[model samples]
Target: MSSTKRLLASIHDVSPRFEAQVDQLAGVLENHLGKGRFAMLVVPDHWGAAPLREAKAFQSRLRNWSDSGIEMFVHGWFHRDTGQHSGAANFKARHMTAGEGEFLGLEEATALRLMREGKALIEDIIGREVAGFIAPAWLYGKGSLAALGQAGFALAEDHWKVWKPGNDEVLAKGPVITWASRSAMRTASSLAFASLARTVLPHALDTVRIAVHPGDVSKPSLLSSIDATLGRFARSHRPARYAELS
Candidate 1:
């Protein structure tokens, strides 16, 4: 709202399955802002598989990334949706994501357990505390909000803003711009949205959150749009970290 124009580049879905793609997208960010200007949203276990603690080399890589000033975030427990949806949830699950909303309807106790376990696992692997947690698909159940406080995460992000977990302290307000490569139609729509955002976003708001998922790297045009979008924002705004938002 202030038109100050702060930029944040985040690499989402950092698991072994997407490591190559993560590296690919990361390289583009590294090229733009140099090492350490971006962030990583790492899933502790993606799709109820591939736990982070089992991958020593990946843990080491995350350590190196953290040490270099790239902020690390606990993405989700198991970035997979295992529940039925209805009404708005159904609409969201059907259109916004490919059913990856893992925390969308979890009970408070279950959500707390997952969040605590995930935070601990990531901390043990990285040997450093994480900066925050972001639920998969940026969707959280009402109970998950309370559970975040119980789990003691310093920060959490939804689609529209970043906030303190326990207290719900709003840190920054802005919609994150991201691309999806789950299908050709999604990729094309995302690019068109991004193209419009390129010309309109900076003038309308102060903060711009560019969240890049690994799958997006698989599409040439999506990747190109990401690069161009970043370039356009960098021309007017300086790179920033979410932790520094407040």
Candidate 2:
């Protein structure tokens, strides 16, 4: 497993900035996990107040890259505040969607209602159905399990990517291509290059997945770190996307 050679990246926050960064990350996935071997996490329905606009833009850019067939998973109904805050590792439980409407306090009926509406809206815009889901920050309340399964997701990458809500499990996992903060997008070009550097090192022999933030591309040092990481990883592993495994 340590010598594995695939890359699965999850993304959030769909915006014009998102559209730009996703392109660079897709390129990393392409170079490392070529030919139907990469995956992108999609917001599907998000915006903080903008709704599905960013999701649509992101989808459009991805569709353009479909010739390579990079796969996508519906990330979350709302990638914002469902009782969640940034600036911490514990975001695992707090992050959710505005559509999820006060997740900690809402009744299951309300939560399900918001999730369903978000799904329907995204599907309408994409002209197809979503196959998988990962909650924002991989955080979900107990009630979320049944509702998500009922919503029809075949695969999930939550809380360590272990197959779940179940009695059985699989090695379904991915990586976090993150940096010091959320303001990293200011240096996209440099960041992309830094990822290339990392892909070539001998140390990253495992099936690696790098998590990217819209902010990663903003800092020169951070961007350089990413490219360096990618370069280091690529020295030994063949680039692969998750859809190929499915």
Candidate 3:
């Protein structure tokens, strides 16, 4: 590992609905960093439907992961999109995530409520405090930001930067290298982006994030890219937890 660069390997959407996929991807990531070298963004109740409390087996797995050094962060409350969007946000919701912006247009109160509940539930279940909160699709509304601050969440992330809530302190700045396989165009573009980033990013940035979603396991190309990207970065950077960045 290079002393000048750091990497964050994150597994997204850890839920009962995506259990098998999550395990598979985790295994893949482990091959790169060993166990406990990554983080898991947990959805308390994915799509406001699949609640973690109901999945006893999955809860146990999460607890073990937590104990073994996998950092946990509360993701969106429901991991769904229920509000309308406009401007750049609208375009992002429509294109970037297919409308999975859970915190994009939430009211301050609503956002706070969900954030508090989700964080509390995750902490209770895992018997450890969650390190941060990241909204679904990396979209955070002004209200959501306000809510995060009021809720006393110390860390939060948007697409290009990681920041501390209440203080507006930036911890890192860089576009995350991630993949999307929801459609043909998205898959093609994502692979192109991954390839380009792998070739270009190490020269320009000190910190890089590789966020892996469960759906990525379904695509062979994505898995290959993930492996190559991780391998490439590992040669020149050290694995880091998000908390260490701050």
Candidate 4:
């Protein structure tokens, strides 16, 4: 492999519920990086609704994308944080995300079950192995980490880094550049961070990851920011698949 720095892009919260939004983000990414160049983090069921198993058309679409070389990743089963927490988990559950860290408070058995089921479901739909597993909001607890290793996922990522679950080998090191659209404050902050990153990250790291959520489609400013950020990096960084890091 060449030693060139790379850019990794992905669309998050992919499900029937956000089909339109995912399409919009995908289109934007394709415009900059071409089709099948980015990954999609699919939620098997979004907030206990819009299960992928029941969406036949979406399943076909996933398979088509998979066949086209787009990577699929098991994002989370429900993509909702419903469990109680305490201490560090409690702090992360309350502050790191707004009730979206599905793996942050799970027990080992429950996490393992969800991981297996989610991986199986995505693989069946796509007719291929998923690229990896990533917890919603990039938050993980002890049990989630333990279960990730047992679940046999080759790759897993948090906010700061991507690593192999089995041997804990660090494949990439850098904070993921992502945007949030839930609130005005978050939107502004993320935009500012992305602007800074667009200028600084290329010179600072060999691998840069950018993730966009379906909610970002609701904000025209955020979408525009995403386009500009992606276009800027696409010039300096080669578009890369997550699997390449492995």
**Which RMSD does model 4 reach against the true structure?**
1.3
Ranking by TM-score: 4, 3, 1, 2
lDDT of 3 at 97: 84
- TM-scores for the candidates: 0.95, 0.67, 0.97, 0.98
C-alpha RMSD between model 2 and the true structure = 5.9
Q: Candidate 4: TM-score?
A: 0.98
Worst 10 residues of 2 by lDDT: 94-103
Scored by Cα lDDT, where does model 4 land? 0.92
Candidate 4: the clashing residue pairs are none
Separately for all candidates shown, the number of backbone clashes (residues 3 or more apart, or on different chains) is 0, 49, 0, 0
Model 1 poorest ten-residue lDDT run: 1-10
TM-score: the better of candidates 2 and 4: 4
Q: Would you list the clashing residue pairs of candidate 3?
A: none
Q: Residue-wise lDDT of candidate 3 within 1-246, one digit each (tens)?
A: 577688888999999989999999999888887889999999999986789989999999999999999999999878999898899878878877877899998999999999999899999999988989999999988899889888877689888999999799999999989999899889999999999998998888899999999989888999999999998887777888888877
Off by over 4 Å in 3: none
State the C-alpha lDDT per candidate: 0.85, 0.53, 0.90, 0.92
Write out the backbone clash pairs for model 1: none
Q: Which is the better candidate, 1 or 3, if ranked by TM-score?
A: 3
